[model samples]
Target: MDNEGVFVTKRSIKWLATLALSASLPAAASTCGDQGVWLQVLGSGGPEVGDQRASSSYLIWHNGKARILVDFGSGALLRFEEAQAKIEDLSAVAFTHFHVDHSGDFPALVKASFFSPRTAPLPVLGPSGNHLLPSTEQFVTRLFNESSGVWPYLSDHLSGNGAYPLIPHELASNSTQPTTVWEGVSAKLSGVGVNHGPLPAIAWRADIGGKSIVFSGDMSGRSGTLEKLAQHADLLVAHNAVPESARGVARRLHMPPSVIGTIANAASVTEVVISHRMLRTLERKEETERFIRDSYKGLVHFANDLNCFAVP
Candidate 1:
């Protein structure tokens, strides 16, 4: 069956029913149990040092374990440590794009994992490359390629000589359809290509514990792939990097509040979490919320570092 049909299936119908029933209850704060699913923001800000917020990063907690890491941006290592997350516990590492603000701390996590007892190959998924950006595999190789990588000392990760092997999966950067990146007993991940100017990018979706959450990553909302992927999702973590008045390159690279609201409303997501907050957007919180509310009337939240949202 087609991807769109997957959402209207009997199982998804029941899932939506559950969300509707739970709509009246408030989502618990920073609480997720062994039987529940939760999303934690490791870094909610963009590439601005003055904001005192980390770059784009997130963690998916399922069955009391940090099963999926969305991105390991700058300063995310400290946040990971503060959250008490173990790199050994992650089922996979998924990257939306290779921007510094989105993937600066990857080596840190790999080095940290060297101290863990894990020996299983780690799956790293990202978008395919273009002339402007490296593919996921190329990006990993450039990090520890033994002969030419900046950190040749850590080449053991690429070679089999390290604690574990690094497995890289590069999804098509132009495909509008969702591509499955990882799947386990209870956790499944998929990504769809998104427009981030010349940079290849993806928007990810995770289904675990019968709940769904979609991460918009950093997209301009020109491809419309995110809406299809986020259809009926329990929650959407979208970037609020630009304000409504933004134009030129800034407007082309990031989606403003209006686009985010339209996508959230179109996807029928239960709630929306506005993250990847930049100083420009943060300064106009009231105006941003007003623009988002013009089209989406559901629960809206402004994210912060270490803030957790239970997937209801």
Candidate 2:
């Protein structure tokens, strides 16, 4: 419950390319005779400026390949490679929010991918923007396409040679129920908006094979849609950024361990993985676990960078 393996072989790489090209996406990568999906904690820390750990990020590996990336935070690209996750195997990325700690390493990832031999397009899903922030389309364009973006060289990545296309998807920030975002050979993705103060954030759920993993992202305890999206999930990846009951302004945007525990228990999740680890939460692991254990009896694991959890 507190531990996380990653073994890659030549056969796996061959299968990865074959799968990536043949199907263009996973149809039931989890449902086949294969084992199940694997989730890796690519980043374990939050926005602490210059922390040693990576920021909030994760990987959803199916059929022995890292196919879906949950976030692209600072230092995550390094961890992603450290875990031996091939850049070419990634099919899509879901950004819970645009917070630097959650989506900061995107440019680095793209830069790294340029060195790989990938030909397929990479799909990106993000929350709809409002007056305060840019929508997913605007974000991607401004970051990689528009002339005003930081990286002017990436403007034509979506349709140019020697570049894997970046397909951007902007989800409605008001969605409460799960809406299918992407479907692959073995994976089906869904997104549902959750309250996160003024930030337009959303939680993501992926069903691979037959098992399910729900990512709570960052949420204020008020969203009941999280429970619905997480129902009967095999694993619930909840952020451990706040305390048991959270205090002050943090309470308005982050869910405490108790609230997270209740959501997992109510949804009858088989396991819970606490990530997006912050200094306060990391220092008070025992206290945080105690509050969570009070409501959820299932296994609870505090995540660390590169920890891989098998989604069974």
Candidate 3:
């Protein structure tokens, strides 16, 4: 019963797990094709300090192109570039909420992509309005509007120019089911609002070439919407911002590890990727893992920034 001298090595287990995953990936090419799909963790940190991690962000890649960009928090832009994702190739940009930690890098992405030769309309999608933060369309206008936005020049360049038009798709959800927010050549995005205290947030799920990946944006576990959105997903990227014993304000805004398992189990996801790790959860990772493991039996990983998982 001695729990002493137990050496905990960071990244070892996840490294091996991902290595085995990579072997199943389709033969070398930029495009994933039907043989594979993958996720690139841009930022795995939460709102506050998280060692070297950036805030919540993720990318879904297929056929050598970044098909979807989810969230754009602090430090995410750098990580996005480091991952070599071309904005021109992105089918859409989805935000879980308007919180800075989840949607801060929008202007940067727009500015960066403006320079690219991309002429297609870029879809930006998020939950419906809440008084707590600006609505998705308002968020885009406030940052890129001609007169009031931060980058007025982008008003013409980012939109209405027939080039690099950033189209905002604000989901005014009146139902609990996952609604399709975007559809493209090989990707389809669906979203449903989730409980996040007073903030309007949503969980997103992407079906690419018949494979699915769901992102459980910041949530309080009060709503059953997450389970519906994540149903039968190939990977479930749930936030591990708190532990089983989380209380007070934190518990009101985020779901701990056990709740994550419950949702993952209910949804029947093929894998569980625990992200948005805060200091509290990182310090007790073993305990967090155990809590989730108790409820969900699937491929689970404590994701690190830039980690890639080739979807099976």
Question: If ranked by TM-score, best first, what sequence of candidates would result?
Answer: 1, 3, 2
The estimated TM-scores of all candidates read 0.90, 0.87, 0.88
Candidate 2 lDDT, 209-291, residue by residue in tens: 78899999988868788999999999999998888767878999999988988898999999888898887777777677667
Name the candidate that leads on TM-score.
1
lDDT string for model 1 (1-312, tens) is 000101112544553543454355454354445658888899999889898898999999987898999988999999988888888888899999999999999998888887899888899989999888899999999999999998888999999999899999889989899888889888889999999988999999999989999999999999999999999999999999999998999989989999999999999999888889888877776677667766986777778888888887
- Segments in model 3 whose C-alpha atoms lie over 4 Å from true places: 1-35, 157-159
Greater-lDDT candidate between 1 and 2? 1
Best by lDDT: 1
Better of 1 and 3 by TM-score: 1
- Cα error, candidate 2, residue 251 (Å): 0.3
Q: List model 3 lDDT by residue over 1-312, tens digit each.
A: 011111233646754554455344333222223336788888989878636789999998887788898999999999988888898888888998888888888788888876888988888998777667888888888898888998898897545874768888988633478899889888889999888888888888899977999999899888889898888888898998888998999899999888988888999998778788888777776677667766875767777788777776
